[model samples]
Target: MGEVEHVVGMDIGGTKMLAVVFDDQFKPVGRFRKKSKAKVPPEQHINNIIQGALDDAGVQKIRGVGMGSPGPLDPDTGVIIDTPNLGWKDFPLAGIVQDHFGVPAVVDNDVNMGTYGEWCFGEVQDCRNVLGMFPGTGVGGGIIIDGKLYHGASGSAGEVGHMTLEVDGPFCGCGKNGCLEGLASRIAIAKEVVALAARGDAPYILENCGTDLSKIRSGMLSRAIAAGDTQVERVVRHAAFYVGVGVANLINVLSPEAVVLGGGLVEAMEDLYLDEVTRAVNDHAMPFLRKNVRIVPAKLGDDAVAMGAARLIHDKLAS
Candidate 1:
């Protein structure tokens, strides 16, 4: 065998950071992760997190670095154009990392990475076309056509969340009304629980958050369901219904061989919501679309994005 090249894969998000070293076979050799605090500037904070991971792995040289981050980014130029949660705009992430470490770097949207990871090594490995959706702090989507990750014009093609779900529903952080994310995201669910609590129906959430309705989170609703709170179950079902509606629309349009769902919410509550979403898609999607689409849980779990980032670098270099 020829000399092998090691690679570092990093996932950067609003709340946490992770780094992993991968051997030539793409198996993880080592990993590091930590909560991200607010005080650090974007560039320095990312560098520190990556450097910590490098130290933990006890290696200085690598083939290249791959990074997946929350998007609306320019993957071609490796510029994070803007991420509302991360407070980044027009940031040259790949360039800075390459400059600092003297290795090549590639950056892409997290969802894109997730889909690629699944297609390469997870649930969609056998499929030529796949649609991947991640539902957590917000909603994001990615598509693989003919086994290639399609970065549409300006690298903003797979933004399934911004699609309009309701004409005049809740306002999205992107300043749009009735976007899928505005209606079906974790933040949206938390808002609904807070509203219900304000109306005296969220005792569980109130108790969980220490009587502060403002502190209510989606996990509280999940806990309430675990505690047999009928009201929370009802709220969750309603939220799942919207998510189903949105997903059904994607099934109709994309008509991919597989549709994989990921993210914290999906990983934690998939059993609770999967049936509802699947039913909605089967019932509402076009007959041919429904006939061809296979809805399943993503296989990579929390490591999907990071692993996908590593694969992205590998593919880049291999090509």
Candidate 2:
């Protein structure tokens, strides 16, 4: 090609950080990871992660760095406004990485970046308007309209999780009630499972976790559902119903061509969960909106976020 180019893609998660070096064609050259230490100085922690990736790739000239970070980040300014899990506030992540590595840097919400990744190089390429959602420890979303990422006025858009659902339902981590996240996220599912096990109602989940309900994870719940546990199916179906409702609301508003769902919970639950979720969306959404929007799972899996971060840089270069 014209020149050998490389970009560092870093995913700063709540519990861990992963950094990968990708060649000109976006294939991984090497990768590194470290336990996320929130209490550590934000700048120091980010620098360490970057250095780890550099060491793994054994490179001296990094073209650029793109980070998929937890929200809420000021994407325009490359500042991390705050992330509860990372204990960071208004952190100048882009500047820090750029100053340390002598390369351009970009940052965006992890889920948003994941959406970008899918739109650019994954399953959503055929879609002009897309609602990308991730249901993991929490629910987050990113919207792409006309092939451009849409960040609302305050640089804080696509917060599907915060959408009010019941108006007076369970409390969400965002200090709201009846949020889709409150009703349908992994934490919410686990809480439901815990309560059921407490009442001796979820023997299958209990058995999957070896009677220690605390050990029951979203993965175990998936396994229980796969093994045909009614209790597990019930919990998942309830969560899927709420998720579908939330997605339906999105379709009504954005009128996206596709709604791509992914993340740990969606991946683990597999097709059944997605089918139930799509069914709910189809039933609840307006007829026109429901018919026009296609619901599908993200194809990139866990790599979507990191790849999207890398795509941010690539797109910038291409443009």
Candidate 3:
């Protein structure tokens, strides 16, 4: 008799698109997932996923929609300025979604959505200020200040991966050298592991993944570490240390209550990564800042971005 009230949350990544239908209370009612064909226009894929989820949930009334996408985009205007992974430039993602669904739509950086999800529903909910750093194929950062997301003047305040860690370090995906991401990301670590395996230094990796760089995933690396592959452990520890350095700098500047670490690598090698990162932060951070701050792992796993997107729509409607 009454129309089912629902909203949609979408997470758009280079390889996949996930759409979830959420009831008014933020419980997931239905879900749809599809590959993101980078060579094709994103509109159709996005629409298909949302519609599929809605159809599965049998919902007729959608309050709004929210999306988490890769950045260098304008959140204020909900435009995807450029995403190297997807080759989308100057795309009005939110507008397209809104037009298709006939409801309000909001968009923000994927990692920012993850940060918001953690802040609102994950481990950092009680903290007024929190910093989120995720090390995946790349490293991403997000900040919550005074219980609000802080989008800088350019709406890119939390591009912490781009921060220069060395004057002349390895080149980053952003075409810059010495970025934190270049020094310490899953991609960066994988490169080192592959090279070592090629040279016969990491027999475990070579025996498992062969010479294929693409095969050197976080799960594989974690298995190598578990099997006591010293080379893999060293490389991963080094990368985690650099990540800690970046976290230390953020602590010195923002003094957040907690620093949340997430991503595939962190999830797989939680103990190893946490141990190294905790040590590095304590070693490098200012004594005063390190005293009270807690460095923790993200709890939401893969659902963070989607849940955060849903929360964004809810917040917008409430405000």
User: How far is each candidate from the true structure, as Cα RMSD in Å?
Assistant: 2.1, 1.9, 1.3
- Candidate 3 per-residue lDDT, tens place, 36-101, comes to 884546787788889999988888679899899998889888999999888899999999989987
Per-model TM-score on C-alpha atoms? 0.93, 0.94, 0.97
* Candidates ranked by TM-score: 3, 2, 1
lDDT of each: 0.82, 0.84, 0.90
User: Candidate 2 regions off by >4 Å?
Assistant: 1-4, 38-40, 208-214
lDDT for each residue of candidate 1 in 1-319, tens digit (9 for 90 to 100): 4554788888887889888888888888778887766477767777877787778777677888999988888888899998877778999999999998888899998889888888888866889889888877788888898888888877888888888988898999889999888988888878777777777787777667744644655566677888776786887777777777888887777778988887767776788778778878877788877886778888898788889999999889889
For model 3, what is the error of residue 259's alpha carbon versus the real structure, in angstroms, after optimal superposition?
Answer: 0.8
| Candidate 3 residue-wise lDDT at 229 | 86
| Pairs of residues clashing in candidate 1 | none
Estimate, for each residue in 154-237, the C-alpha lDDT of model 2 and write its tens digit.
888989999999998999999989999999888888888877776778777766664564576668888777776777678878
Winning model by lDDT: 3
lDDT rank order: 3, 2, 1
Count backbone clashes in candidate 1. 0
Off by over 4 Å in 1: 1-4, 38-41, 210-215
